[model samples]
Target: MTIRDVATRAGVSPATVSRVFSQPETVAPGTRQRVLTAAEELRYAPNPVARSLARRRTGNLGIVVPDIANSFSAMIIKAAQQEARHAEYALFVTASEELVDDEERQARALAPQVDGLLLTSPQASDACLRELADIVPVVVTNRLLDSVPAVLTESAQATGHAVEHLHALGHREVAYLAGPDGYSNQSRTSGLQAACARLGLEPVVLGPFPARFSSGVRAADLVLAAGVTAVVAFNDDIAAGLLTRFADRGVRVPEQISVVGHDDTALAEMVTPRLTTVHIPAAAAGATATQLLIRYVRGDDSGVRRYELPSELIVRGSTGPVTARST
Candidate 1:
């Protein structure tokens, strides 16, 4: 139960046992194996806090998300936790509640306590994030910046495909139910714009709405007023909200209006008339970010400054050919 007992049983000095636990790469392969075997036999485990205090490496990774309750963030965190555990590390997570000042404060505070940090869909500006990176090893997911290492889903191509799909369904005019201004909003918006231009479809920009269900509900009237035949929401949260509002108003989806969403979250399926959305690889992005940060913390550069996962447009029940009512 004690490291000292395990060290004695392994026929190795206590210092060597400590080194094996903290910096196994520094120990010989056979010696490391012996120490591990002895520890396993004795049911011995190094105390995380004590070991961290001695070695200055907490063996922990910190992650910050904008909304902890959001399904996308939940999936990413779960994946990050699994990947961290696989590397013999643990995860500490906190939410920023979508406030810029709170995000920066929480991230800065969490930096010193962990070996590295993973930021998911950060709300802070790039310059501020760069300052944080200067203090600790950081891996960012769902956003991209040249100054900071990042992993994100490359949504532009698939978003373009979604636009094409809408256009093919005879939806000439489409409104975008937007999210709050951030790198993610910029990316999704630009991708959609470029696609509309290529297809010669009229694109109406409807909102700079929050990434919340309420925003989607409020935006429904605006979307209806725009008189567009179809709508592309920023994410599933907004899309689901739109669904609820449309149902309450007796607006038949796909007949009166077709709706498309991004980040194919569980809500995509749970809503009445399942959402047609672009499938973002949230779990893959999370795992990759965790792996990259842990490697960076180990002083190993895998040479990946940025990583992008693929996406696809998943056609579902929410979209269809435009009806005469839309016209």
Candidate 2:
């Protein structure tokens, strides 16, 4: 059903229905109730595209991410959804699956239907990002953009700090289990490399890993053979995988090999040997990005501002001083 149909059933003009959304105070309370009741009974979901064309406001925010399965992405989506609802807006989320073409397609497809777009380290090139910003306001999360504002969680820097933590545990060799090839992965790799360089330690960068349990399972052997006392993973999923794989291999955690992961997701502390990881402020970043996009939509040029949130290391049972001998 359409809003027009709802309007007819409510015996009100389409304008009145629109007013019920944008300016409910302008409509009589009785009439607003009728329209709402009709809309609910009819299951009428508004055509956001039509609304955008008519009012120049979609009342929606488009969120594009590389992978929805990532816990970090899930947290951001949750927070952004809450902030959007609180501001009387809607949230639309799409995934790119780490494909540049798919990222571009999702961005273009959702742009016109949303008042603004939030990208989580989009795979598109700088030129593509610039074009996207030209078409609509874009807020990049955990990614850098020259033409658009961004809310960054400093994942790279956090990764660096994680390395330092591992190094302080007397680990001379450290390995990184990385996510897929994207701007975010590059940042993490660079951060690890920088930290390793400063410590005069060798950094073993492995796999554009799938950022999943199975991928971590596959990476276990490589991690064990690398002779690294501590291994930092792409995220909590991989860290959990690492811990499970090590257990299956009869290698005790921390005592045999220290493991660390990024994104202090709920799963981080749930396992037997709780994961040590970098805590990305995913929720706060999401809420802040939504607020910035809303301001931009409201004609506040000041919304075009970069906000950098802090990240911290959450040390857990998974990491410790280097073991004297392999388990």
Candidate 3:
């Protein structure tokens, strides 16, 4: 039976019935028992998880990611869970596997079950994202939206610094191995272009490879073909892949080719030659997005808000002064 039917039998408003199932602590003991008894007699299952988005304090939040397998995404998810726990709110997380359509579908399914949503590295178009914001409170990270609130890394300047580091070491030409053509890729591209123009260095761009270690391994052959002394990877996963392939081909890092990575994840250090990378504050961004989402849920503010966290390049053994370029 529907919520209204249960409410009528319990002699209470539909909202009260919802609160009884979703937030029983708010209901009087006697009233809660009466509602429970009625639901039992009617054989009604509230399916609380799916119905948690009722118009009351449901104490639940939702989060969506482009790809859950990515280490950067994992870091954000873990941090968000901690923040949600501290706030005494439950979090529901799902991924789109980097598909824009699947991301939209999953988000739409989740919208009705939580008080607010945290979106990380969303691949959805602006129109789709705006539509979702109209349906539920939305806070995004790793991307900037014209209308929706966003928390992102301001990395263009830092990206320039990465290029400058190469230039300082006497490398006049650099290549970039990219991931998807999403907003993140665009941001890096903008930074690279600006840096090259300002420093008068030549820049070469390689494939928009999948953001995976295997993909990077495949891209390693292409990097050697580009004939640049240095290369910047989209992320640490791909950066590690490049190292693996370069080693197999007998291409010594720094001495033959220098490499830079983004999102300085744990893999940066685990590799043979430590990677020089751009550090994105994933944990802080997750916590901050969660805080904003809850604030919106509690009616603190409904207007759009924005946050741009900093990114820095970490130098390591992966890069060095220009050496003889490996053929």
Candidate 4:
């Protein structure tokens, strides 16, 4: 029914009913319980849109991802949705399909409709992200900008761990199947480079390839052509693709050449030779980013700029010691 109906049934004023729903902490416990019971009995539900308009808040949050179809993005979305529900805020999610132009458009469109925005692995440039933040509160993930608060996975550090693991396995020469240009890719590539340098190993950097399974299939030939003892792929999907391609070409993984991948997605284990990978905490990153955005929406202006999550390297069947021919 309505707040008035509930107030009448509860023998309380309309203001008290409103306070019980919106500012419950200010309402007395007995009065709060009475209002809640009456509202439940009357099946009364407040109009969120009207409340938002009056309060100058939408009670809605927005999240934008590069590719919602990707497993990594899917995990983030799932976790973020749960967090938003727990906070009693509605989530409006959009996928930019890995296009920077689409990402910018979505950000602009979502800004007016949402209280704040959560950008996960955004492909948009630093300038565009900052401008969007000017329109609404923004918290980003997988990207670090000067002013924008970000929840970043330690992709770079994890890559270093992957490199060390390969090194320990006696892989002197390795290849990196690179992904498309973005903050995440940049961080990963930097980590690979640093690790290679520290370990006194040489790296054969391959394409700014599409981070897709098909791309991994094509990279299989390139990996063989480069003749490295091991290869690290952009993600598990690509590594799985490589496994299929290598099998087709009669190249045995871990026997002839070892392989590793990033973002230890489920695909890492489903393949014939389980993929060794860097575990990026996709769920944790999503939850943390939502929490940060909510904090900003509530006007908690803490000076925290970045939140970096830890990642680890998981050694699996896909990687092994260098063989005689590989060396």
Model 4 residue 232 lDDT score: 90
RMSD of each: 3.0, 5.6, 5.8, 3.3
On lDDT, the stronger of 1 and 3 is 1
Global lDDT of each candidate = 0.89, 0.85, 0.87, 0.89
Winner on TM-score between 2 and 3 is 3
Q: After superposition, how far is residue 272 of candidate 4 from its true place, in Å?
A: 1.6
In order of appearance, the predictions have TM-scores of 0.89, 0.82, 0.83, 0.87
Candidate 1 local accuracy as lDDT?
Answer: 0.89
lDDT of 4: 0.89
Instruction: Extract clashing residue pairs from model 4.
Output: none
lDDT of 3 by residue, 171-274 (tens): 88799987887767888889988999999877888888878888889998988887888999988889999999999999999899999999988888899899
For candidate 2, write residues 1-327 as lDDT tens digits. 766898899999988998887667889999999999998999876666665556678778899987798787898899999989998888999998778899999999999888888988777888989988898988887777667888877777778888898888888888899897765677778888988888898888889887777788899999998887889898888888888899999999899899988889888979869888888888898899988888887779753499888878888899888767742
Candidate 1, residues 13-67, lDDT tens digits: the string is 9999999988889999999999999999988989988878777888889999988
* Most TM-score-accurate candidate: 1
Clashes by residue pair, model 1? none
User: How far out, in Å, is residue 131 in model 3?
Assistant: 1.6
